[model samples]
Target: MSAIIRTENLTYTYSPDTPFEKTAVNDVCLEVEDGELVGIIGHTGSGKSTLIQHLNGLIRPTSGRVIIDGQDIWEKGVNLRDIRFKVGIVFQYPEYQIFEETVFKDIAYGPKNMGLDEKQVGERVRETAALIGLDSALLEKSPFELSGGQKRRVAIAGVMAMRPKVLILDEPTAGLDPGGREQVLEEIREYHRRSGSTVLLVSHSMEDVARFATKILVMNHGSVFCYDTPPNVFMRADEIAEMGLSVPQITRVFSLLRKKGIDIRGDVYTVDFALKTINEYIASKGSAREDGHD
Candidate 1:
């Protein structure tokens, strides 16, 4: 399938043509395929956010082009508002954006703007709220009256109501408890599965990304550091550490085990994989012990 999003030599400058000018993204090129779940990761000030903004026409590239579904999003006469509908972005702490008196109104805002029929907007609002785990009864209540986690879910439902083809989330679970975080992440995964949309998750947690993303993009100092599957990316533990990043905890544990002379693979990123490998090792050692006695 063709790329849902593609960047060619994408660059962005902050305070351009001024004394305080700085390049936030430099000579970057990448492609995000249709229905792919991708994660963008970086330390602070690595331009991850800036890069994502270009994808949905939120920020026009200072140089080069951003193509969404074979069309240059910045092209003349192209309606950016339409692009936004196609590429939904949920900002960090999206809950803060909620201003409507009721959760239903907040979630319906996007579809309403699209001129959808009232019935369609209501249907979308209810469906999206359910997808994000928002209670049906809460739809009529003021959004500000809800808990922080609940507000976050409402905000996410707001975007999902639009049914965008590409969904981009910037730290969807920031500042939530473990349970809240898991809930939000699970909702996002379920949305992707049901909609078959392209997903771009920007997060700092390697473990979370490893669990959800099919591909990982590591950014450092306004450039692409690496892009690969989680296992392949985490395999370079030393390099990742040098870049002020880290592999998942399970991967790190396996790496430490390898250093201690364990005869097992060190590249395991998921807990399930790590546990399976450990069990196999134990079974093999047990067989060896029996054979030695025989």
Candidate 2:
């Protein structure tokens, strides 16, 4: 897998040279492989948002470079709009950005902006609506008339309609009910699997990341804390706790169980993983007991 997105010494400062001057992101370097589902996590004010803004040239880097598909996005004479089309970003609570009268047109907005024909735009609108679990009937209603969860899905569909090479979402499941959250997260996972597009999910939910992400990028104080697979990153529970962040609850439980000499896997995060680990451990225990009795 080649690197589709790379940042070299990326840095961004807010209100530079002023009394309120602050460095939001600092000298961060990273590489996201093509077709990877990467999760970004950090505490508030840890520069998660600032770091992503630089990916598609939403925010010009104060220093360093952002390279996408082997081209520097900040290169002079580069078309920013084209870059945006290739890297779509859905901000947190993206529903607020929806203004079109009907859901169909709202979802079609991005495809239309790309100068796609009506047929192409309509196809993308319908396809993406389905991908995000929006029914065809909802496309006829006003975006504002839908429920909060529906509106969020519409906003997400709008971006997905573009079929960008890379999709970035910031806290996409925020403020949704438990069922809505699960539905949205599962839909996103399916979308990534079906589209084979690079997906960067900025989330605070360790469980979500643990279940879906192939890689995890942890940030702290505007710098890359670590970028590793879910198992490896969650293994450093102590360090994550020190940064005011936490691993999945199941991960913490298993870690404690390991500390107690339970001889169980400490890296389990999701419920499924924990259950499998426990079942295997129990089976092994029973087998050992039977052998001792023999």
Candidate 3:
């Protein structure tokens, strides 16, 4: 299948032609296949946010091209606004963008901007609100009056109401408690599953990315460091650590266990996989003991 989005040697520089100018992205080429969940990780100022912004034409690359669905998003006369509707971006603390009086209105904002009919806007709002686990009764209440988590949901629902083919979330779970983080991540996963939309999650949490992302992209020094599956990327734990990043906690634990001569696999990044491996090891040990007795 063709990539939903592709970049050709994409490069971006901030404050070009000025003494303080610096390149934020450099010769980075990547692709996002349709309906795939891609995780983006990097230290601060690694250009992750800048790169994603180019996906939907929010930032025009200083050089190279960003193509969405086989067309250059920055082509002259291309409707960038329409592109945004198809490629929704939920920024960090998106709730702060909420300006509507009611939760329903806040959620409906995107579709309304798209000139959707009243009935369609209302339907989209309610459907997306439900998807984000927003209570129906709360839809009538002022968004400003809702709790932090609820307001965050309203912001996410606003993006969902646009029915984007690709959703890019920058730290979608930021500033939330553990439970709230899980809630938001689960909701985002469900939305991706139900809609089959491509998801680009930019997060600093290795654990969350390992749990949810199908592919991982690691960036450093404003360039692509690696692009692969979680296990493949996390396998270079020491290198990742040196770069001011970390592998998932389970991966780290298994790595330590292997170092301690426990015969455990170091590549296991998820809790389920770790448990299965440990169980198989125990079973093997039990069989060895029985044979010794025999």
Candidate 4:
């Protein structure tokens, strides 16, 4: 329930003082509570990537501060190595980063770098592999031999093996089939539930975020548009669209019904919720008709 990740007036610029200079992230203040799964969404170039880069200590903010686990990451003598270990980032197409011959070794790489012994690394790798739904039989096979989704799970498990306190995933499910996407996201949800570590998922899929995230962080024009629960964020359907991001398709449908003078709740953000709402509405109307007959 405490804040594990906090950014105070965080700002970043590219090509500073040059003709190509531009602010990518500006005065962004944000907080992510420990063990919370947060979905970060925005239009292209809305600073989602840059902002998260700061959290992983991969980029220095032009100004402001990035505080992780109650310590300013940039403060004097604050070790960046330690910060990176605390915040593990799995980038898009992380499969390309895989180099080890075996899936087990790929997953063991991080723990090994952390100076873990052979026995410890093996234990960590197997535990993380199982956590991500990778089979024990597949651990010995080459990472290249796995399916796209399996490769992704292996790469993600590689990061998880380090036992980071905060995990940041950038476009984690990108390019996967719908089934693959669902499997990966569900595994991520399970990982968060079992590990009790905070997760920041940077994704463009409104439905994915709506389905899995405890809270949503909407970014716009390099600023914090809003940070709230799924229902609260999706309720601003029109405003979100105006920012070049669509609400979940179901949310849009409910919004359209409201605009057409139908009495419908505007907070529908998932297919399952939409179905429930529709059934409830029909039942209510039926009840009214029965009352009239009585």
lDDT per residue (tens digit) for residues 1-294 in model 2: 789999999999999989999999999999999999999999889999999889889899999999999999989999999999999999999999999999999999999999999999999999999989999999999999999999999999999999999999999999999999999999999999999999999998887788999999999999999999988888887689778887888888888887888887666778988899899999999999999999
Collision pairs in model 1: none
TM-score of each: 0.95, 0.95, 0.94, 0.95
Q: Write the per-residue lDDT of candidate 3 for residues 3-75, one digit (tens) a residue.
A: 9999999999999899989999999999889999999999889999998899989898999999898889888
TM-score of 3: 0.94
Clashes of each: 0, 0, 0, 0
List candidate 1 segments past 4 Å from native.
283-294
Residue pairs in candidate 4 whose N, alpha carbon or C atoms collide under 3 angstroms:
none
Model 4, position 234, has a per-residue lDDT of: 82
Q: How accurate is candidate 1 locally (lDDT)?
A: 0.91
The candidate scoring highest on TM-score is 2
lDDT of 3: 0.90
Off by over 4 Å in 4: 286-294
Candidates 1 and 3 compared: the better one by lDDT is 1
lDDT: worst 10-residue window of model 3: 258-267
Please give the distance, in angstroms, between residue 144's alpha carbon in candidate 3 and its true position after superposition. 0.9
The C-alpha stretches of model 3 lying farther than 4 A from their native spots are: 261-263, 284-294
